[model samples]
Target: MTCTEEAKAELPSDARPEIKAYLENFNSYDTIFIGYPNWWGTMPMCMFTLLDKLDIILYNKT
Candidate 1:
């Protein structure tokens, strides 16, 4: 709730926060949906943290 406000301010800095969720076989999944709060015309920096942790090179090609 309150973090949204803080995240908005931190977006400009491109901060990659360490997300609490973890996936061992990220690449094994055939499909994955990435949903996030859109602030400042983009996803939160926390999204980048999860994205960066996942093997997203071959993800979502449509």
Candidate 2:
């Protein structure tokens, strides 16, 4: 399936899995490594979902 189709199907829905990995204590680390394949010139919709769930602040990223 295409990214557009997948986004339409998954973005508006809650089918994304819960995030089970963390830094033991999130604030314990000042850095994070997020890796994803560049699909269709951008990260996947699931990545957005994960980012939203993590509530990361873009300004805080270094």
TM-score of each: 0.70, 0.48
CA-lDDT, candidates in order: 0.77, 0.63
CA deviation > 4 Å runs, candidate 1: 56-62
User: Which tens-of-lDDT digit does each residue in 1-62 have in candidate 2?
Assistant: 57467666664564554556644455566788999987556666667767775676343665
Worst 10 residues of 2 by lDDT: 17-26
Model 1: per-residue Cα lDDT over 40-60, one tens digit each: 888888888787766364556
Candidate 2 Cα outliers beyond 4 Å, as residue runs: 1-24, 56-62
Lowest-lDDT window of 10 residues in candidate 1?
A: 53-62
lDDT of 2: 0.63
